[model samples]
Target: MRVHSLFLYPVKSLAGVEVSVIDLDDFGPVGDRRWMLVNDQGEFVTQRKLPALARIGTGIDERGVSVHIPGEGRFHLAPGHEELSVLVWRDWMNSLIGPKQASAAVSRFCERSLRFVYMPDDTFRRVDPARVVDQKRVGFADGFPFLFANQASLDELNSRLKHPVNMRHFRPNIVISGAEPWSEDHWQYLTIGQARFKAVKPCSRCVITTMDPDTGTKDPGTEPLRTLSTYRKTQDGVIFGQNAVHQDGDHLSVGDAVIICPQES
Candidate 1:
């Protein structure tokens, strides 16, 4: 399938930036969710708790990353700001305490005792339960920074809906067109340009997916998600998009041909 659009979330829970091309590293895309806001306990924060974060805008220029709010002024962040140390997620207390902390700009924006930091792509961090330590460095993501979705799937959902929905509701890092609806659901691995990604799991749906990205209103009286709940419900929850764990790769651009290889039975 052909790529329709590309996006990056420089910081988690905030509005993302649209780009034509992005450099795909081991963790995901460069500058994508490389920074995040966390409370004093070091747990990552997001729009799920702070919906206002959805109003924040992030941009990348030659200088570096810049954050902008509707009424709040702009703040710039230095590159590799969170590379000083490592941050770990503690399961005993369900909090994030770390040797690394959030940047001052991030602290001011969130207006809490939270710190923001970046995790270099070369660093290794452990995620609980899975015991699958991710060597591909992640920025300020809950787990992975990039979430890829298929445009055809969205179209299929919209076709069954009374009112149309924009892709913004899905908040994906990459939206590829030309594939059959929900084709990504069965894809075992996808190779776009030099980037290689393994479809690890089905991403569960949250209120965030039901929220109106433009008006900031919550509405789930729609199809697909509701229809999906009928059968796609996993032990964890209802599934929507496919989550991917990727290895390092070169830059991926629009119009780049995506190679899809389904898993063997």
Candidate 2:
């Protein structure tokens, strides 16, 4: 198989940026999910609650990150002086509140008070202890650093749905094209280019998948997830893709050769 595409979400729960290549650090992708939107209480906010966030454009460059709010304006995010405590799932983390102007601009767009928070190099959030025993870290992602999805699997899912959805709806970091439908369910280890990844857990589906990546509107019939749950439901939840942990290496690119192996019998 080959790497079909790569994507990075500079800010968690916002539209992602597609790239031809990605540099890696301890975090899965160099610019992936290092920034997040938080509420007045410092609780992480996401598209799950406010689907309109998907309309906000995010970009990353050599210097830093920026966000473009429709009609409001575009602002290059700058780390603010104040350090604040924030909540991401069950974990409480240290994050730098971004500049007041940027926060206020985004707040106007969302019609609520929201702050852009950055995960500085000094802060370290470990992988979920129940799933990974290693001391590896993640940025602002929900769990593991990488999410892998198969194109054939999406094709198969599309075939069963009245309206087909694209990979963006599911938000995978690595899109592999050559695998068969649902073949990733059996994938235990994979080598994409020089970096390796362990298929740590099957990613469970959520309502977010039912939202269009472009408009952030829910499918009228509640598709893909609805079809997937009919047959893909596991003990964990309605499942679709695999959550992976970066094993080693520092970079990967589109069209890189992908080699896979199932767990030994």
Candidate 3:
């Protein structure tokens, strides 16, 4: 198997950019989900409540990051010196608040009050201790440094759906091809290019998967999820992809061979 695609989400919950090559830092992919949106309560907001977020595009350059929302025009966010505490899941993380202009743009796009924030070098949010013992840290991602998905698993899910959802629905960081459907479930460790990653947990499916990443519209029947409930249902939720943590090495590129490390008997 080989790396089929690479993705980077400069801001959390926005449309992701597919890249040919990416550097894997201790925080997962460089510039991946380092920025995010939050409400007045300081809690993070995502596509789960606002599907329109899927239409918001993000790009980063030497200056800083830019957010583009149709009609609302483009707004740029530079790293600020001010730090604010924001909530993601149950953790309260310190983040560099984006400039007022960027916050206003995001609020208008979401049609609600919101603030833009970025994780700085000082803010080290540890991975849930129960999930992995490595004490690794992630950016604004849900819980892990990386998310890996097999194309064959999506192929199998598409075979069961009427509309046939694509890989974008899951928004994984690393995508692999040429593996049996759901074969990642058995993988304990994998090597892609020079990077070694340990599969930490099976990513749980949610309503976000039912929404169209391109159009920001959701399926009325909540497809994929509805169908997944029948078979992919677990005690926690419906499982789709695998969450991984970087263990060693660096850099990933498309077409790099993926070697599944053998498990000890």
**Each candidate's root-mean-square deviation in Å?**
4.5, 1.5, 1.5
- lDDT of each model, Cα atoms only? 0.66, 0.91, 0.89
Those runs of model 1 whose alpha carbons end farther than 4 Å from true positions after fitting are 79-115, 120-123, 126-135, 220-228, 263-265
lDDT of 2 at 182: 95
Question: Candidate order by lDDT, highest to lowest?
Answer: 2, 3, 1
Return the lDDT, model 3, position 235: 72
Q: Please, what are the lDDT tens digits per residue for candidate 3 over residues 1-265?
A: 9999999999999999998998878788999999999998889999999999999988777776788987778888877888889999999989988889878877987789999899998899999899888779999999888999999999999999899989999999999999999898888889888788888899998889999998889999998899988998877679988999988777999999999997521
Worst 10 residues of 2 by lDDT: 256-265
State each candidate's clash count: 6, 0, 0
lDDT of 2 at 240: 86
Higher-ranked by lDDT: 1 or 2: 2
Better of 1 and 2 by TM-score: 2
Task: For residues 1-265, write the lDDT of model 2, one tens digit per residue.
Answer: 9999999999999999999998889888998999999998999999999999999999888668888888888889888778999999998999999888889988989899999999999899999988988998999999889999999999999999888889999999999998899999989989889988899999998999999998889988888888898999999899889999878889999999999967522
Q: TM-score of every model?
A: 0.79, 0.97, 0.96
Model 1 CA lDDT for position 132 = 33
Candidate 3 has its poorest 10 consecutive residues by lDDT at 256-265
TM-score computed on alpha carbons, candidate 3: 0.96
Model 2, residue 129: distance off in Å is 1.4
* 143 Cα displacement, candidate 3 (Å): 0.6
